[model samples]
Target chain A: MAKQQVISPLPGTFYRKSAPDQPSYKEEGDQVAVGETIGLVEVMKSFHEIKSDFAGTVTKFLIDNEDAVMAGQALVEIDG
Target chain B: MAINVISPGLATSVQDLGRPGYYHLGIPISGGMDRYALRAANMLAGNDEAAAVLEAVFMGPELAFTQDATVAVTGADLPPKLDGEARESWTSFAVKAGQVLSFDYLKGGARAYIAVSGGIDVPLALGSRSTYTLGALGGLDGRNLLAGDVLPLGAGTAAAEGRSVPAKLRRLPGAQAELRAMPGLYWHRITEASGRRFFEDTWKVALEADRIGYRFRDGRPLEFVERTPPFGAGSDPSNIVDSCYPYGSIQVPGGTEPIVLHRDAVSGGGYFMVGTVISADMDFIGQLQPHTPTKFVSVDMAAALAARHDRQAMLNEIRAMLA
Candidate 1:
């Protein structure tokens, strides 16, 4: 199967979980669904959900939690 | 009603220049963050310069028009799409009835202003249509537009399409920004060496940048001069007796991060303000994106007033170009 990637739509801080105390939205090898929020991009204090466009299994994350991200940057790789 | 909200983007709110004179009552002057962009948009759409417009941050709203209208998007480089076809920013365009208007991903800047022909007709609260979401005072129900909400439009003549604001007239932020600030308020609280460090350091906009204020990081922490705490003031060196925080005040708490108060900030606070970003540069701060490199350039009163005059002159030039 080919792999796909999810990209950030805005430039800001990227978080894998909803909050500091929450569990990761997805783990490696976890199944993913289209429109499922994998993480959040916080820009100018507003949080925007970064949803996966391709449904597949979580292969790897390109960025770590609480990482600063730029728009159009690839975030995670998924195996479809 | 003339427009229907399909998707309210991230934070779409109705705003004008702002409602001043009520700060004494704890009401903030909530308005569009980029006042110059808002004015230019209104001018391009043939509305009064201070007419209410929709301010979308980060993302653009998906709106459906119930009637034909002239529209213009300004500020950010977010491209407007009419019925899935792309349109230019800073230029007036026409939207037919039942057409859905969306946007491409943001290219640069932060917030975008959408101005319609007749302006948004949300009932005025305190002589302005701006929304103060914290106090729930004005704008459409004192909140952002939500999906499926229908907004009424005031009656006005629409301008011809293709009216574009000149490139030079657009007030977009560059790759790096320098904000001219005048040291005042509690500048004495910090040691002179710390003041020099503050101006010399290069800071980046923190994630806490918003309507209320913008926090900066990566700069060296400030060192405060030793002093005994006054009554009613907290023991922290960065604390003072509760004081009115002027707009554009640069407040630093714990002698660490500096927060520049913007349009929707609280009227007063206990934090000691080290300085104030001059009035002319406040609009520039609104267009800055998170993580942008920035520096503080210290200036005196004479230089601050000169910059303000230059800003006003630029506004006049824009007004003429759109006229």
Candidate 2:
């Protein structure tokens, strides 16, 4: 399997889950399909979902939760 | 001549140049924060200069056109994408029915404008279509566009689409701005030291900055000239007799954070207005983002008028190019 990266579409703080105390959108070894939401990028208090483009199994997140990210920044790695 | 709201991005609202004559009735001139970009987008979309456009703040919406139409995305580098393909800003493009337009993150500036070939056809209240959400006065039921709200469209003017504003004529905000302000009104109430400090200090925009007002954090509390409270005025040190606040007026509440009132701010208030940002600089100020450093430069009325004239001339040039 080839490892592909899922990138954030916006510059903001990346969150693994919708909010704290909630289950994460995706976890390592979890399966995801194209257009499946993996996380969220929050900018200026607005939260936008981060979706995966490749159908694959989640490998690992490149950045940690609550980290400030730039546009097109790598968020997670998916094993396609 | 219709659009389906797929994902109404943050606070997407219908706005135009706004109704200006109703301020005395406590109605604010609620319009696009970045009017310069709105006008340019209208020109590109072949609409009238003051035609209604979608004003997206902090983020952009995902809109699906119901019919083939021309559209322009302008202001803030939200980096719009059509059907998942990246599109250009400050330029018009054609949208086929069922195609979707979305945006990437904001790269520069604050607000992003989306102008359709035919303007957003919401019913106008008080002679304008601008949304005053506070009053629920105008626009699509006088509120922000929500998902599933299908907006009607009007016939556009004959302005050619695909025309672009020159790179030089485009107004984008920088990390910091030196906004021109006219100091006076209740500026007398401000202590001389604090008054001087305001011009010298570079203040950062607070997180609460929005269409209503932009509050700045200068780290220094402003001191006002000591005086007894006037009738109807609260007992705050920055208190004043309630008066009409012109758009872009800077009011310091609690003598701490200074807030520059924007399009959707209250019509009048009892707070002291230390300065009024000039009309030309409003375009610049409107593009300021949170955390952007800003300085206020005081200017005379003549200079203010001259700036306004220059801005009008530049708009005319863009119109001439589009025409």
Query: Which pairs of residues collide in model 2?
Result: none
Comparing to the true complex, what docking class would candidate 2 get?
A: incorrect
* DockQ, all models: 0.62, 0.23
lDDT of 2 by residue, B1-323 (tens): 68999998778999999988888888888889889899999989988889999998767999998788888988788888999999889988888899999998778877889999889988888988999988998999988999999999997653444678889898887767888999988999988998998888888776577788888886478878888888888788888888888888999988888888989888887888888989998877667766677888889999999999999998889989886
Model 2: what is its DockQ? 0.23
DockQ of 1: 0.62
Candidate 1 stretches with Cα past 4 Å from truth are A1-3, A19-23, A44-46
Q: Please, what are the lDDT tens digits per residue for candidate 1 over residues B291-318? A: 9899999999999999999989988987
- Positional deviation of A60 in candidate 1, in angstroms? 4.1
TM-score of chain A of each: 0.97, 0.94
Instruction: Give the least accurate 10-residue stretch of model 2 chain A, judged by summed lDDT.
Output: A41-50
